[model samples]
Target: MQTNNSVLVTQQIKTWLEQVVIGLNLCPFAKRPYKQKQVKIAISTASDDDTLLQDLLQQFKLLENTPIETTETSVLVVTNHLQDFFDYNDFLNLADALIEQYNWQGVFQIASFHPHYQFAGTTEQDPENLTNKAPYPILHILRESSLDKAVESHPDVDGIPEQNIAKMNQLTKEQITELFGYLKD
Candidate 1:
């Protein structure tokens, strides 16, 4: 039932999750859900903003209606389009609007990832951007209740970003390229 491209993308995402994310301890919270098979990766074929928004809403609804134990979160991988970081960033507003419209604001939150995820005001080459950068554009949808629980249980939740940035900064460009070779053009 799966296309070749779909299978490949899913496997690539799994590799990134296991190797880059968990291997480097970039996201301490990711390993558990991934290991438990609760993280769903949905590939979207929408080639433009209009269609992508529809695809986003559908994923949002799927996560909302599904049982939490079976599905904790979803990553909407926009492989057909939104390769441009700014375009991907701008589309998030529409995603939030849809969430608000469906009254799912508190139920879910969106985190962004892309190949070139530069935070505002930061230089493009800043290693800190690696925190959010992925092999493709991804909108990570998470349940707020679970997130809140995780945050409440953590001793130093506030230090996570600083720690991630510091960790990423230690890697030189060659190291990053070697680790994330698939992302290169």
Candidate 2:
């Protein structure tokens, strides 16, 4: 069930997501092949499920140099799966290049789907809790979320696919607060 507050939050999220979609230039679905195919495919966060991403990549390769705008044929990825050994810059650089060259625009965002409100935590039984515990700029995300936890906490966003994990990006608290206007003490 949703409360009036939730309803308002949803509306806010919808509005922001819509603007994001336009800024990123994304569509719900790619146009049909015979219908001046506008979209290419959906990009989801890296996951155990590669079916969607793979299929989209295949279609994209088939029509190289098609002159589609960055927003026309891409979806931001959203997922919570990853390996321990991951390089952030390398990944972002590669992803950014592909988008620039292919004219694909959108954020490939990822979230751990963890319930914790903070970015850093450790196992309850760990002797030191340092091995698995690492500090992240999650507080910033929460600061962003604080503006409207309901919307920021979306289980699923319908805009472009989120490409990377919800790591601490450079977005300022003010920027996030602006993105979500419900922040209140």
Candidate 3:
């Protein structure tokens, strides 16, 4: 059963995906799966890393068992933990290890998003960090095959990061606040 808080959180994520991600074309490939309703949003209320990993495993299993036509991808929203960017970044190692442990390296991959997702050598205030910032910590589970297909079809797949950074740089303060208001509180 979904609680009111979970419902609200899911709605916020969906809004961000639609308005910031798709609206600004941060991810050129997101629109189709989103429009097709093949994206699964799973909320995790774990307050500790161990519990969070269990939640993550559940999502991984879900993706592993489900067919691609039914669910193309999943976003596991970690609501109660990893609020610190550094901790979240470090936790990615464990996430990657889990994939290797299961020998799912080429079968599945995880893309991370967080409320404060600063890249290496970049300060917290850098505009480019907004490219991966989200309302909450998210582990996006993607099918490796699907990604290969997307990459093969995209005309300039390697330029996506540069394009996203350029878009982030163009955002005004007001626009950033409007699009990412959840981060304010």
The per-prediction CA RMSD against the true structure, in angstroms, equals 1.2, 15.6, 0.8
Report the lDDT tens digits of candidate 3 across residue range 73-155: 99999999999999999999999999999899999999989999999999988999998999999999999988999999999
CA deviation > 4 Å runs, candidate 1? none
- Model 3 lDDT at residue 96: 97
lDDT of 1 by residue, 49-81 (tens): 989888888888898789988999999999989
Give the whole-model CA lDDT for all candidates, comma-separated.
0.87, 0.32, 0.93
Worst 10 residues of 3 by lDDT: 176-185
> Which regions of candidate 3 deviate over 4 angstroms?
none
lDDT tens per residue, model 2, 1-185: 65575455344434433443232233222123213534332223345424433433444454443443322332222223322223332243444455456554432222221111122353433222211121110100011112243345545554323321221133356654553333221
CA shift of 20, model 3, Å: 1.0
* TM-scores vs. true structure, each candidate: 0.95, 0.27, 0.98
In terms of TM-score, which candidate is strongest? Answer: 3
